[model samples]
Target: MAETPAADVHPPYLYPDYKSTRLRAPAQPLVRVAPSPLDTAGPTFPKHFVKDSEADLTTWGKSAPLGEKMVLVGRVLDEDGRPVRRSLVEVWQANASGKYPHPVDDHEAPLDPNFLGKGQVLTDDKGRYRIVTVKPGAYPWQNHAFGWRPAHIHFSLFGNAYAQRLITQMFFPGDPLLAIDPIFQSVPEAGRRLLIADLDLEHGVEGVALGYRFDMVLRGPRATPMGV
Candidate 1:
């Protein structure tokens, strides 16, 4: 009989901690539960929903979501540099007003009745996906005396299986708040560049929406530093 090998752990410096010196890192589950029959033989990769691959944050209701219209596009690739096709990608972000459409958000900004601030899309055969949304505004936080979070969008990706899922936040390239935001600083400086989306007019529609390209590499030497 052969023994099992140890798992590869993520780099610690990349993840943020409220009190890293005192608090211990997350512990891996004791048992590796095998996928159940339902999970192993699920319907399709992603079950069809009312809006499975709709990435436009605007146009949910009678009017479009407010703010600067921009296009977000990216490719999903595995550690081996192979594309992960048909992966489900989901994104949630604050409106241009820097407020979410949730009760927990106490920001003074007014919410757009038409903007739900959530969307989902699937990667195509080339491992590419795109979404159209407004640039989220920076919001104040209570972390410090005058804490504020940089404009960012939360992203979730699911590969062929749930175990291959990945989650991260995408930031704009020139956000001034990046220097002061502790959450953005959590990632090691070397890996921080991977989180910022770049401006790419090539991917944008002519005079329609500005384009930002954010590629994600799941695991390995080029893995995007995931938030703790």
Candidate 2:
């Protein structure tokens, strides 16, 4: 496994201390076994985990959610810059009001009955995927004094199977709260910009919604930082 720098982690004092003291040194690398016939064929995965690639989160319920509609489009690529087709990409986020559709989220913001804030899609032959969803709102957190989380979406990419996975978060470009958000700040300064998606007018449909492009490189020097 790749080792993330210790400085890139959230400060121990900001979060719970119980797990902080239990941290240990990195484990030794294990000896590799030669690939068998099954390993040589690579991972065989099921298709259409969430039905199709035209997933629209805002229209999940009886009506569309009240918020700014946005279109997210991106491609998944390997370290060598080749497209990774047939991969599964999943995402979830808080509603436009900064409230989650879960019991544990006790934020005072009102929930959107129409918005479930979850979507999934399978990449095409060209490794491209698209989603239509509302922009999530920033919310407060207890990680620091006057702490506030930036509007973002959680992404889980499955390259081949359960063992080959990369989890991360996507933030909007030019978010002022990112500087103070401990989770976003946990990433090293050099690679932190990779997490922010760029505005893409070319892929965006005029008048309907704005668009953001967030291409991901699974591994390499340009690889996006994965969640630990």
Candidate that scores best on lDDT: 1
Q: Give the Cα-based TM-score of candidate 2 against the true structure.
A: 0.79
**Clashing residue pairs in candidate 1, if any?**
none
Across 1-228, the per-residue lDDT of candidate 1 in tens digits comes to 111122232234224333352245544434544555433322245446526437777778688777888999999987677787777888999999999989899999989888888999878888898898889999998767688899999998876544456788999998999998877776667778889999998888787788899999765212332221
Off by over 4 Å in 1: 1-44, 50-53, 220-228
lDDT of 1 at 228: 14
lDDT of each: 0.75, 0.74
Clashes of each: 0, 0
What C-alpha lDDT, on a 0 to 100 scale, does residue 27 get in candidate 1?
Answer: 45
Model 1, residue 51: displacement in angstroms? Answer: 3.2
Q: Candidate 1, which ten residues in sequence have the lowest lDDT sum?
A: 1-10
lDDT of 2 by residue, 1-228 (tens): 324333352222233322332344333443444433433233545774467634789777888798888999999887667777888888999999899999999889999999989888888898898999989999987655677889999998876433346788999999999887766765667668879999997777799888999998665222323221
